[model samples]
Target: MKICFITLGDIKSIATMKRALGMANPLQALGWDVSIIALDSEENRSRISIECNENVQVHYYKDCSAKEEVAIKTRLVNQICPDFIYFCSFSFRNRIIKSKLKHKPKILIEHSELASSIPDNKGPKKIALRLLEYYSVYYADGLLCASRYLEREYHKMARQLMKKRLPILYSPYAFNNDVIDAARILQQELNERYKNNTVLLYMGTMTRNYGLFTMLQAVEQVTKQKPDIKLLLLGRGRHLEEAKTYVQQHGLEPYVEFKGYTPENELSSYFDRADAFISPLNDTVQDWARCPSKIYMYIPFRKPIFTSKIGEPKEIFGDDGHYFNTNQPDTLSKLIAALADGRLQKTDVNIDEHSWDQRAVDFTNWISAQYAVRFAAAGSEVFS
Candidate 1:
């Protein structure tokens, strides 16, 4: 079957981009054709080759007005003529989907974070998003749940609106196979550089929702006892200036450093170099909705993973992850200190078991089974 992935974000800059790329190679191996459409960054539309193989065709248009953008998407939709169109987040196919595509391809929404869960989205904006989300959830042919919370909540949501249950595919973030060798090479370099320090790594958006300030606060507390401890933050977001200010006010300049958005290719090395991984998510609705993409990415390295005890990570990680019940920075401070002091132990996670290739295999098998079931009930005419 041919599937087209439509993303509204810049190429390789969002979760959906990675989700599409992670499953592409495996899907292709299983006799599925893949194509990608990027709505933002005209330069990146053509450069999709950098991330995907030459076999995967790409589509996009140059800078244009909103009306022109809609026209371009409509034309591109007809040209590809895919059996399925997979997308994610707020905008429906980056804010445009055919009134009806040529093939009537199925729509799969890979849920990330919902606006209602966000603290900033309040009043009329939140209500509007709820309406949009309600329509999007029921309108799609199926859902691709990123977190356990989303899968459970949205499944119930869909059931409340319709008699038939919507098809679901649980595809969380997985490690990149391509980065293994590069990560190994970079690990040795990082080992030599941070030999004398307690290095903890964090990679994600620099927003309040992701717990940027909470992480820095933990670093500030840790620095009091372990002056040489280091927290390397990779990625920049809206809270970058605020994070810097927190570090400065607390005199954590020596302990905390912002590395700024590291690309996907270079991330694995940084992962290997860290003594532990830090993802301080609050016990908020947004946190519950997300799968903690960084947590899955960190597992491959088999390093100590530190996160909140709430949601799916606690259930999935088990002994593998260090969990904290409190949102207090002091609670995290103790854990970091324990790991750095060799008190808290590291657990090994089977990399092959959680690799993207493995996830893709499960994802494809489920998809194939779903198609077979559909064909059996609707009589092959459904597939066409």
Candidate 2:
């Protein structure tokens, strides 16, 4: 069998990109041919490389502008006629591909809580997007939800629609152990500088909805009582300036360090040095549909985690680490300081179940099953 995997970014970096890459490798290992199509740019093509020896090939098309990007994607779909096309997010490209393909299987994976992920809108743009979303969800052969929560939400919204037959697959984010081990060694070196201080690391994109502003305030509160605590924020986003402002306002400048836009290659080293990982994401309708990608990264380090009661993290951990109410700085401060408590140190958050390799293995089986069922349904003519 041949699978043509498609997405909008580099297959080696973004969470969805890496997951697609993971999907490609195992399928190839099982003796299937695989090809990946991404937003083919000169910069991305030059920087990224697929590791598979021969079974897999990566085709990059130069998309000069946003308009050109769509043109290139259309061209790739026409060229690579594989058994199935697995893609992330919904767009004009997916719709065009589905309409054009004669007998190809296509899976449209929802990476976020769609209705909630969009910003608060009032203009014509909001109205247009709402309509676009309705069609995108209705037309796909299969709808893959990143978590069970999203699947439930999807069903609730489209219960009356005929699209119920679309298979809802859970596509969780994953962590490669080899990557974790390498990151641990690098983290050890970084930790040497803050040996006397307890380093609290916050990984992933720093955004307003991420509750970094509130988390920063809580850090300020914690530092006032325990001056030995320090914070290292390791990602960049639109709200970075706001996070800096929170630090300044709370006089946390002395204790907090802003390490912006750390590459995925260098992330593990930062994770290694962190005495504890904190993601006090705020509770919003958006967060309720979110699947925290950071949790997969932090669990393998075997250090305790600090998070809010939002979406899948609470269910996944279930008292394995520390949990706090969202937006409550006093409670958050207590949770951060509580990590140093002797009892919390020994609380083992079981990460073996959450490993990327395991997730990939499960996904591999699921993909195979999807193929088998569809192929069987299509009868001898389609398989041949």
* Reference-based lDDT, each prediction: 0.74, 0.67
lDDT of 2 by residue, 1-384 (tens): 556767665433454655656556655555456787766664345434523345567887654565666666666767877766666666554334456555655655555555535566547776776666666567666666767678786765566566665666776666666556553546556767888888889877778667777678787777877888888988777888977887788788878999986655677787777888887666665676767777877888878778876677767766665787766877878877776554455556567778755765566556656655222321221332
CA RMSD for every model?
A: 3.6, 3.8
Q: TM-score of every model?
A: 0.89, 0.86
- Considering only N, C-alpha and C atoms within 3 Å, which residue pairs clash in candidate 2? 187-269
As a TM-score, model 2 comes out at 0.86
Give the residue spans of candidate 1 off by over 4 A.
11-13, 40-47, 63-67, 90-95, 183-189, 373-384
lDDT of 1 at 206: 88
Count clashing residue pairs in model 2. 1
Regions of model 2 farther than 4 Å from truth = 10-15, 41-55, 65-67, 93-95, 115-117, 183-185, 345-347, 371-384
Model 2 scores worst on lDDT over the 10 consecutive residues at 373-382
Q: What is candidate 1's lDDT per residue for 1-384, written digit by digit as tens?
A: 678877666643665677776677766766677887765574354335545687877776665676666567767878988787787554633545557456677777778766677778899888887877777776788888877888887887788788256887766778766656554556678888888899999888888767787788887888888887899999888889988988888788888889996655567778777888888777888888877777877877778888887776765676567876445888888888898789997666677876778886786667767765222221132342
